[model samples]
Target: MMTFNARALVPTIAGFRDEVLASRTACTAAFAAALHDTLAAKLDRAVAALHEEAETEMRLAAGKGTEDGDFLYEIYHTCTTFEHLWMESGPISILDEIYEDVVAEGETCRVGLDYTVIPTEQLGEIGGILDRIRRETGIEFIAARV
Candidate 1:
């Protein structure tokens, strides 16, 4: 039962062109913490909507299942959105927010996200948020399972 998680990796410079594959810390801890907090809030908001939808689905499927109850359980399980996964996975502090070095113009970060069970229905929304993080920070955000 893996859940969704996210991490940001900031790349360092080698005078351009040359890239270092180092997971070294790039930005200040304060900066990273600030981003983490802000992202968490945004994710919370997005997940709220998903939770509501899931609840609605469960309600709609209620009373339909009988002996096995598999139908009911499946409906409930399918509603597990990215936000739900994050909540179930506990605090995000355990995830990796470390900085890394890469060959790119200016500063960049890679966000590694794991344990996220993003349903197909919410991909566009979640993807938009992830993309916004990169655009806003001017950093390369990479989301992957840890």
Candidate 2:
């Protein structure tokens, strides 16, 4: 398993949180506008007894809320994406079942985490785990000064 030190994730997670916080207001406004546009289009087509299932589905997906009906789910998700790392209390095992290349020792001394090296799917999965951890503990992870 590829183990990652919690400190290694600091920069990427902090950047994600900052980005979400920065664009939250704009994202919310854009989502509302897109939803309104979709509804208008649907109404227009309804008058002619026609509908675009794909277009409606796309709009709904884009505007879908979080588990608790939060409109800015993406922002919230990004903001809490690295919560797991802070609370891990141990190194993160990327491949939990495998132990062929575990690097449990000297993990903290490593530099340049480069989170972008990880595939998008795996990163999203990690983010989901972090989100769950935050929700369960009701703790917001804040960056520490080095």
Candidate 3:
């Protein structure tokens, strides 16, 4: 019964990026370091929140005698892609792309909530939020099973 508004984190990420950009000074190295630290902290918090949510969902599914692989798969797919973008592109580019994708894709669940009930729309929002964070923060969230 946990209500996770996936889109809620997008603005947070955007705000974090804006703050870093605003604080950028003539020192390139210092700017980069500050950006990285700020973004990493935000992404870490998001990842932790998502992890807890996923764990709760998995446990709920398990109690119903069902495997949560599908849900996990969805999370893995999104997180892995986010990690890749984080590594490949710098924060801003990746964040922009992720936000665009989310806007374009609308909302769709890549994985089901209870192994059978797929909240596709909400999932898309969730993925989008995470994607933006990953892109902006360059925080590669290491999945437990990926």
Candidate 4:
């Protein structure tokens, strides 16, 4: 339930960038865990695989600034581009539904109980979310980037 005060913290570019990263991680994790069980598992696996692949590609990029260092990114991109037409043998994906949320959303959907969500007129939307955040901290935010 810990959260940084956005206006108080995200004033500089680096702060904004870091806030975006944190928000992406937080929002995405919340949104994903709320999806259908099977789809959620699929998403979890895909994100992990993509993250590992991205790290490898980034490492290759870091080895040398030249395009010749390695075609790691290109190779992965090409494989995906041709995935449906041809195939390369690879590991099978299996879903092992583990304990829920790692941080905010713990073992249940209550991870976001203390979140600072903006109110919207969308379906299933809860009211007073932003007010809740404001009242507790004595801070009013007209706009929060995240």
Candidate 5:
């Protein structure tokens, strides 16, 4: 199993979050447009499609509301894309995760997560994300940061 010490990732995570948050206005504007176009019932699916387009998935986010769903959509904002910002709880969750990482000590920190757990096929999808982010914003992100 590949293990990461959260301390090493603090800057990267924070930097990533900073970049995401820095673009919050643009992301929210686009997300708000999408949200405006989508129906509440299909919001979860819409979010899923956004993840697909972004080529990344949100972990620990269980979409909750009138109907329960297989994919976690309750909490959001783990990923850098715009999908998470649509949910009310997303920004908070990201901030909370960052806070936990910043304060917690060895063996307690959970932010320095590894992606080997992500399936193989999805790796290619994620690679596309890296390419786009680099091509568009010049941010190295976690994949190429090292």
Candidate 6:
């Protein structure tokens, strides 16, 4: 089983947000750079594992080379292409959950952010979350898949 240490990035993300909100532009930029570094390292390790799996399958298929050679070749090509795109774009799916709290005849807004690095087949889940967030929060969010 593959595991990701997502907790390690929490502090970096929180610090970045805090610095940006504090109006410290340079510090915010630096923090963002640092966050990107962490993100890249984590993503690289995940992609490497995926590449290894794809290569292994490809090798097995090559040895067979009976009637599945073309299919296996196509599958291998697709996997590699997906890995390349992810590495180049650093794609992530982010969901912002917003809620309105009404108390003392006044309303306050609360927002929560959740995100994940989507695998190849789960791309639709990201879009679904964005749609739900917009409907629930009445806020239009622009999300990038990459």
lDDT values of the candidates? 0.39, 0.35, 0.42, 0.33, 0.33, 0.40
Task: List TM-score per model, in order.
Answer: 0.26, 0.22, 0.27, 0.28, 0.22, 0.30
Q: Write the per-residue lDDT of candidate 2 for residues 80-120, one digit (tens) a residue.
A: 32333333333322222111333566554333232322332
Best by TM-score: 6
User: How do the candidates rank by lDDT, highest first?
Assistant: 3, 6, 1, 2, 4, 5
Off by over 4 Å in 2: 28-146
Candidate 4, poorest ten consecutive residues by summed lDDT? 84-93
In model 5, which runs have C-alpha deviations exceeding 4 angstroms?
1-3, 28-146
- Candidate 6 least-lDDT 10 residues: 137-146
Candidate 6 residues lying further than 4 Å off, grouped into runs, are 1-30, 79-90, 93-146
Give one digit per residue, the lDDT tens place, for model 5 in 1-146: 22212233334334433443433434345533332222222333433444453333323223334354433333222343342333222212111122224344555543442222322234343334334444533332222111
Q: Tens digit of lDDT per residue, candidate 1, span 77-132?
A: 55345434343333333134433346568866444344543332343333344455
Please provide, for model 6 over 42-141, each residue's C-alpha lDDT reduced to its tens digit, 9 standing for 90 to 100. 4354445555555665575575656677666555555344334333333332322222244555755433334433332343332343344335322233
Tens digit of per-residue lDDT, candidate 3, span 4-58: 3334444565575554444444225753454345445655555555455556555
Residue-pair clashes per prediction, in order, are 14, 0, 2, 2, 8, 0
Candidate 4 residue pairs in clash (backbone atoms < 3 Å): 104-111, 105-111
Local lDDT at 28 for model 6? 37
- After best superposition, candidate 5 residue 21: deviation in angstroms? 0.9
> Would you list the rank order by TM-score, best first?
6, 4, 3, 1, 5, 2
- Give the per-residue lDDT digits (tens) of candidate 4, residues 61-107: 58565676655545544544222111232211112322234545454
Error of 3 at 112 (Å): 31
Candidate 2 TM-score versus the reference: 0.22
